[model samples]
Target chain A: MVNYIKLIQNENMKIYRRVGTWIMLSFIVLIPILVSLVVLLAGGDDDTTSWPLIMLESYFLFSLIIIFTVVVSSDTVAGEFSRGTIKLLLIRPWSRSAILLSKYIATMMFALFFTIVAFIVTMLINLALFGSTSDSNDLGGIVSTGIVGWGDVLQYYLYQFVTLIIIVTFGFMMSSAFRSSGLAIGLSIGFLFAGNIITGLFAMADKVWVKYVLFMHLDLTSYMDGGTGPIPSHPMTLGFSLGVLAAYFAIFNLISWTVFRKRDITA
Target chain B: MSQAPIVRLQDVTKVIGKRTIIDRVSFEVRPGEVFGFLGPNGSGKTTTIRMMVGLMGLTSGDIHIGGHSIRTDFPKAIVQVGAIVENPEMYKFLTGYQNLLHYARMNSSITKERIQEAIELVGLQDRIHDKVKKYSLGMRQRLGVAQAIMHRPKLLVLDEPTNGLDPAGIRELRDYLRLLARDEGTAVVVSSHMLSEMELMCDRVAILQKGQIIDVRSIRGESGVGSKPTLEEVQFDVDHPDAALGILEGQGSGRISDGLLTLSSDRAGIAAINRRLVEAGINIYGIRVKTKSLEDQFLEMTGSETIG
Candidate 1:
C-alpha cells in the first residue's frame, strides 16, 4: 500500500501545470465551440445537428476520447523519461507497479474530465443557439434509442472510464517501451485509426474474429444499444469485446511494470 | 569503536561487459566517521558507491546499512542511506521546496522541520522557493546536498560532492560535513580525486586502485608523532627517475616521470639520497622535499600513467 491515490494526485498536479496539457484541454473545448457555431449559423439544419449529437459526435465520441487518452498516457512516462525525472521517481520508497498505476489512473481521470467539460460546453452552446432543453429526449430521440435512459448516462460514462483506462494502459506500456513520446503517441493514434480500417477489411473478407478485438468495441454508445449480447446486425457480442479489452489491460500493465522495474535510468 | 557501524560492505564486486569495474572491496563506515575514499578516474569509485546505496546490484557481495542487508531488507537499508551519485536528478519544473516535499512524502517519518533544517544547512533558504530550473549550478548542487540529508539518514554518501564548486563552496561543504560528524554523529562517505581537499576534510582515508583498496590509513597516525616534516619533507627527487630504482635499492618506493624521480623515503635515508645523487653527478634540479598530495598517492597506488 503505497498511498496510490496520493501518487495519482501528485502526478495529476504535474500534468495540470504543464503548458502542453492546457493546450490540449483548450483544443478539446475548441472543437465543440467550433461545431456549435457552424450548426447555429446554418440554422434550420437537420435534427442531427442538435446539442447532444454535437457533444456525442464531436466531443465525448470515440475520436476525441482517443486523442485525449493518447496524449495524456503517451506523455505520462515517456516525458518523464526524457526529462530525466524517472530516476528520481524510481529511487523512492514505492515499487515500480505503484508508480505506473498512479500515472495510469491520472490519465483516466483526465480523459473523463475532458469528456465532461466538452459535454457541458456543447450543452450550453446548443441551448443558447437552438433554444433547446438539455434533456436527452429533446436532443432528437437520443433518449428514445430504447436501449438506454437518462440515469444510465453516469453508468455509461463509468464504463467509458473503464474503456479509457484500458486504452491508456496500453499507451503507457508503449511509452515505457519507447523512449520518444512522439513515437508512443504516434503508435497509439495510429492503432486507433488503423484498427477500423483493418476491421473493415477483415469484415469484407468474412474474418469473424475481428469483432472480438479490443479495438473494435471501444465505443460505449454501441454497447448501450446491445448490452453485452450480440447485436442482431453486428458480428460480435459486447461480452467478447469487453473480455478482450480486459485482457489487453492486464497484459499492458504487466509489461509496463516489468519493463520499468528493469529499465536503466541512464537518461 | 564503541558505537555500531552505520554502513558496511563485504567482498563487493561489480562486473560490466567482461570488465571488472569494482573488485572485491570491503570497508566499514563507523558511526560519526568521515571516511574519504580517494581514487583516480576509472577506479570504480562511483560503481562502489552505487552498490553501497543499492542503486546498482553487486555482482557478488553483501552490503549492510544501519544493520539491515541491502538485498533482503532493502527498504530498511535504503531508508537509512541517502546518496547523490554525481549530479542529483530533479524535476526542473517544481520548486525546490515542493521537490523536497514530494520526496519527503515517500518517507512517512520525515517532518517539515527536518526539511527546513536541511535547506538551511545547505544555505539555500533564499532560493528554495524558486523553481529548480532557474537555480544556478552551485545552488542546484547545494539543493542536492539538502535533499541527501533531509531524512537525517544514518549514512550520507556523496560522490565528488565538491565538484564544480568554487573554493568557498567547497570549504562550506567541508565544514558542514565535519559538523555533521561531530554534532549529529552521522557517518559520511565521500569520494573524490582531489587529494588536498581530502587531506583537510577526512579523518582517515582509503586509497583505491583499480577497484582494490591499496592502502587504508589515518591522517594523523600515518604522518607519525609530532609531524615529521609533514610527509612532504620525506619526499626527494632524482635525475634518472627510472635508474634511481637501482640506487634506491630497498630504501623506499618511487617512480620515474619525465627524467625526474619522485620518491618517499625515511628521514635519514632522504638526507642520504642528496649525497648519493650529487656524488653520482646526476643533475637533480629539483632536490627540495616534495609533498604527497592525495592525488600523488592515488596515481602512485593505482599505477596509472596519465596525470593532469
Candidate 2:
C-alpha cells in the first residue's frame, strides 16, 4: 500500500512538473477572476448576491475544469506510451493493475484539486467583489440570492464535481484503451459534449430507455432545483441519475484496468 | 563463478501475430558475471529481454528470478530484477535527481543515501539537479543506470546499454557494470549488436540468431590471469614465410598468407612450433597471438549479417 502511494506520487510529479499543467491550473484560477472582473466592471445591479453570481460563474468554470481535467486524464496513461516511459514504470515491483490504478488516482486527484482551487478562488472573488457572505452568522440569512440557500451553492459545486469525475474517468478509460494521446483526448472530449446532444436526441424518443442514457444523468444540478432532469418528460430522480452515473464510472474503470493489465507494452 | 543463478529462463518464448519472435530461448545468468546477449537486428534480443522482465507476456514456458517464477509470481519475481529495456527514456521535465527519486519511490525500501550513492556511482553529482531535457544522451544514460540500480536488485538487465554512448562513456559504463557484478554480486544481462564491445565486456556471451541461442561459451583468458584458452590463431612474422610454413607443416594447422605464417595453436603448441622453426634455421622474429574474436565466429555462423 505504501508503494502504491509512492507510485501515485511519481505520477503527480510527472503531471505537476510540466509547464503545461501549471498553465492549465493557472487558467482555472484566471478564468474565474476574469469573469468576476467583467461582471463588476460592466455595472450590474446593486443587489447582486455572490452566491447566485458565483453559481453562474461556476458553470463556466466547471466547463474549463472539464477541458483541463480531460487533457490531463487523457494524457496520463497514453503519454507514457508516447514518451516511451511505460517500460520504466511497469518494470517495477508493482503489478500492471497497480500502476494503472496509481495513474487513475493521480488524475482523479488532479481533477479534485482543480475543483477545490476553482471553488475557493471563485467564492472568495465573488464574495469580495459583490458582498461578503462570510460575515453572515446565519446560513439562511442570505436572502438576496433569491429562492436558493447558500447551502445549495455548495451542493451545486459538489454535484458539478461529481459529474466532472465521471467525465474525467471516461477520458482516462480512453487513455488506457488507445496508444495515441491525441486520439484519446479527441475522442473523450467529443464524447463529453456529444453525450449531451445524443441524450437530447434520445430524450425526444417516446421510449423508456432514454432515461437510462449515461448523458442524461450528467447534469445533476437539475436535481438541486427540485426538478426531475433535463428531460422533465421522464420521471428521473436524483437517485436514479446517481445510480446510472455510478454504473458508468465502474465500467470505465473496468475497461481501463482490463485493457491496461493485458497490454504487452509494445511501445 | 560457482554462485547460484540469480535468473534462469527455461524455454521462454514469445509469438506475436503468428510469427515466433522468440523461439524457446533458455539461459541462466549467474551472480558476479556480465552475460551478453549477442545478436543482429530483428534477432529477438529485445523481445527476449522484454519477456524476462515481464514487459511482454510469454506465449509458452517460464522465467525464474531469485527462485520466483515470473510467469506466475510476477510482482514477487520482479522485485529481484531491475532493468532498462531497449531505451532509457525518462520523464524529460523531471530533473535528474527527481528522475532518480521517481524510480526510488517505486520500491519503498530505497533510501536517500542509496539515491545519493547511485548519483555518485554514475558520477552525476554535479548535475543531478538539472532537468533531463538539458542532459546529453550520455548523461541520460547515466541517469538511467542510476535509476535501475537504486533498488540494488539482484539481477540487472540492460538491453543495448551502449547504444548512444561515446567511446569514453562506453568504457565508463563497462567499468561500472563490471564493478557492480564483482563488488555487489549482481548478475548483469546486457544485450548488444556490437560483437567487439561484447568481447571486451562480457564474461560469457550467448550468441543469439533469429530468435534462438546458437551457442553459450565462456570468454577464455580475459576473465583473469592463469585462465587457459583453447586453440587460437597465432601469426608468426618471420624472414622466410615459406620455410616457416614448411617447418610447421603437418605439425600444426599452419599456412602462409599475407607474407606471414598463420597457425592455429595453443600456448604449448606455439612454444613447440617455435622451437622447431628455430631449429630449422628459420628466424621467427615475432610470434603474435591473435585473440579469436566473436566477430569471426558470428560472421561464420550467421553468414556475415550486418551488426551494429
Candidate 3:
C-alpha cells in the first residue's frame, strides 16, 4: 500500500501552489489587524486593556474564515474534474477511497491552517492593540457578576472550530455530489449565511423537531456563556446539539465517499 | 514465443445508459511490440483506454494487466500500467520538476535520481524548473511521455498521442517509442484515428468501428518465408497507354490514368509484362513499383464514410 501521507502532500502542493490560496490567507491576517487599528485610531474608550472585548467582536471573522475554507474545500475534488487532472490522479496505484480521503484530510488541514492563522493573528493584534482585560461580558452572562476568563474564550474558539469542520465536510460533500466547484461553493456559503436567517424563523416555531435542524446547531459557540438553545426560551444541553451536528457530519461523509468511490470519470 | 502477454481483455463489454458502447471486444498485447487501437472519433478508443486504467468500471468483463485483474486487483494491476487517457493536463501553477515529483511520490520505489533521469530522458533538464504554463504543446507531449515511462511500467498506454504535433515531432516520438519497447521490453499501446501513422508505428493494429473490433492485423513488415508470392503495384509510364493495355491481351485488369499503366503484379510477372511491352514497341519511359499502403485497406474496411 502507498503511504497516504504522500497523497496528502501531493494535494497540499497543488493547493498552496495557487496564488488564490495566498490571497485568502492574506485576508485572514489583514482583516483583524485592520479592524483593531481602526479601534486604536478612532475610539478612545475601547482602550488596549479591553482586548477580550475586541476579540469578541473579532470572532465574527470566523464567518470570513469559514467562507475562505468553503472556497478551498469546495474545489478539492471538483477542481480536479474540471481541470481534467482527475484521470491522472485516479490512474495511480492508490484506490479511489484513499485518494478521496487524502483530499478530505488536505482540505481540513487547509481549514485548520486558516483557523489557526486567524486565531494567532487576531490574538496578537488584539493583544498588541487592546491589552488583556476581563471586563467584557459578551460572555459575562454566564456568571451573575458578568466576569469571565480566557478559558471561556478558548472554549468559544474551540467549539467554533468544531462547527468549521462540519461546514467544511458539507462543502466537500457538495463537491463530490455535484462535481462542480462553483455549485459546491455557492451552496456551502449560501447554507452558512441564509441558513442563519432561515433557522431563526424555524427556531421560533417551538416544535420538538426545531432543535434538530443543522443551522440551529452550527453556532456551537452559542453554547458558551450559560447558553441553552439558540432560542433562549427553549432550554437544551450541549450534548444534544453535538449529537445532531455529529449525525449530519456522518451523513455528509457517507454521501461523499459513496458518490466519489462509485463515480464514472467520463470527463 | 515464451513471453506471456502483458495485457489481455477477455470478452469486454460496456453499456452506458441502455447504449452499448463497447461490445465483446477482446485482444492481447505482447511485450516489445507497439499495439495500436485505430478507430474513428467517438469509436470507444477513449472509453477503452479509460477502462484499461480502471478509471471506468467494467460492466460485464475484466481487464488483466500483468496477470492481475483490474476489476478486483486494481492497485496490483494498475501498478504495472502507465497511461495518459487524454491530453496531459498538468497543474500549470507548478514547475515541470514539481509535476514529475508529484507522480514520483505516488510510487514509493521512485527516487530523486530517477526523477532527474526522467527529466533528462525527455530533454527537459534546462526547463525543468519552469512552470508548465510556459511550455509549448510539443514540450508538454515530451513531458507526458516522460511521466509514463519514468516508473518503468510493464505496459504503457497512450491515447491519441499524436493529436497536435509537427511531422518532425511525430517522427521523433515514434522512434522513441520503438526504442523504449525494444530496449526495455515494455508493451506500448497507441490509439490514433490516422491509418498512416499507425502503419508506420505499430507492429499490430486493431481496427475498431462503432465499439467493435472489426479487424486485428499485423502492419509491420511481413516475413519473406511465406509461400504466397508478394504482389507489388507496378506503374509503367508509357507513350501509348492504350497500346500497352492491348499488349497484355487482358490477362490482368489494368487501370490507365494520366498516361500510366498500373497493375498488380509479382516481380516475375513484372519482368514478363516489361518484355511484352518492349516487344510491342510501347516505348516505356519508367517502371516504378510501390508497396501497398493500409490506407486503401482501412478505407475499404470501414467504408470511408466513418473516417473523420
lDDT of each: 0.74, 0.86, 0.84
* Best candidate according to TM-score: 3
lDDT digits (tens) for residues B1-308 of candidate 1: 78878888889988877988788899998888999998888787877887776667777889988888886777788888777777776778789998888778777778999999888888889989999899877888888888788888889889898888899888988998999988989999999989889988898899887788889878756665666543343433555666666766676566665555767665666778878877766666666666566667666767755633
* lDDT tens digits, residue span B1-308, model 3: 58899999998899999988999889999999899998878889988988999988889888999999999999999988888777888888899989999998898878899989988987889998999999998888888887887789999999998888889889998998999899999999999987899988999999988889999998765733554788778899999998788879776889887778989898789999999989888898999987667777777888866433
Worst 10 residues of 2 chain B by lDDT: B220-229
Off by over 4 Å in 3: A45-53, A134-148, A232-234, B223-227, B230-233, B285-290, B305-308
Order the candidates by TM-score, highest first — what do you get? Answer: 3, 2, 1
Docking class of 3: medium
Candidate 2 structure quality by residue, lDDT tens digits, A91-132: 888889888888888988998898899889988898789774
The pairs that clash in candidate 2 are: none
**Per-candidate interface C-alpha RMSD?**
2.2, 0.9, 0.7
Model 2 chain A lDDT-worst window of ten: A138-147
lDDT of 3 by residue, A142-222 (tens): 223222555765676788888889889999999999989999999998888887797779877878888788888888766
lDDT of 2 by residue, B94-209 (tens): 89999888888888889999999989988999999998999999999999999899998999999999999999999999998999999999999999999999988999999888
The candidate with the higher lDDT, 2 or 3, is 2
| TM-score per model over all chains | 0.81, 0.88, 0.93
User: Which of the two, 1 or 3, has more lDDT?
Assistant: 3
Per-residue lDDT of A1-267 in model 1, one digit per residue for the tens? 555666877788777867778887787777767766775676644443344544354424546776767887877889887876665566566666678878877887888788787656765665566554334334444434432233445555566666667767778888999967888888887876776576555555545665666666665555665454323335566567778778887888889888876664556
